[model samples]
Target: METNEPNDGHAGNPFTQVPIEITISVGRARPLVRELLRLKRDAVLPLDRRVDDPVELYVGDKLIARGELTELEGDATGQLAVRLTEVADLRDGL
Candidate 1:
């Protein structure tokens, strides 16, 4: 076996700088609009999806992951995460 040395040739860690974005999709808007138009001062518009539905996570307009909205130590969080889909790997041939 040969000893390995630290490779200082790389500029930086790619994983460390990976950008991530999270977004929430409430529901459709056509019925919501009609309901809003008929509402009074105090009104509520019920969403089509449940609270435990999966929320989308994207990376630069590409869908990458999904998870449920949750709370962590009193702070809202997304737990039970899952990487549902990913865009084509751009760095494969580069």
Candidate 2:
């Protein structure tokens, strides 16, 4: 016996191109004591990482990419240097 498949003409392909906004996050670590003693005009705090370190990128709180900090025309930007991890299912959906 053969099975009959339903063909609605659009069941095989049901996805449409759309614009999506990706939210990114950058992490910075600093001393706990410095945070506790923060002043209005004091600048004695030191960050845990250097300026050359890569920043973490996130999508809705999920870590997705890691990239280095870049300065484009004096504006700070995050350059996608590496893709640490990605959602395989999400890629397929796209």
Candidate 3:
């Protein structure tokens, strides 16, 4: 049986603490089969996007947001991060 119980907040949700992985898609490469097979160490595979192009963030197969790649400063210097530029309306679902 199902009942429409009164909802409080995230504290009552079991999935609140569940971990999910978000993938940041920078760009794609479409190398030919022969070209792919000829790849070796130190070979540069060029992508379709420039360095400053916006990257897409995806949760599974769903695109959630778009952002730009940036480098961290301070104690976490050298670490790469994303600066969100656009976010999708996810009120309906993921």
Q: Please tell me which predicted candidate would have the highest TM-score against the true structure.
A: 3
lDDT of 2 by residue, 58-77 (tens): 66765555666554443435
Kindly give the stretch of ten consecutive residues in candidate 3 with the minimal lDDT sum.
Answer: 1-10
The per-candidate count of clashes, in order, stands at: 0, 0, 0
Better of 1 and 2 by TM-score: 1
Instruction: Candidate 1: list runs displaced more than 4 Å.
Output: 1-21, 32-34, 59-61, 74-94
lDDT tens digits, residue span 1-94, model 1: 3337465554456874576565545354456566767988776666667766766665566655466655553343544334343344445521
* Residue 23 alpha-carbon offset, candidate 3, angstroms: 0.7
Residue 8 CA displacement from its true place in model 2, Å: 22
Ordered by TM-score, highest first, the candidates read 3, 1, 2
Q: Lowest summed lDDT over 10 consecutive residues: which window, candidate 1?
A: 85-94
Candidate 3 global lDDT: 0.92
TM-scores, all candidates, are 0.45, 0.43, 0.85
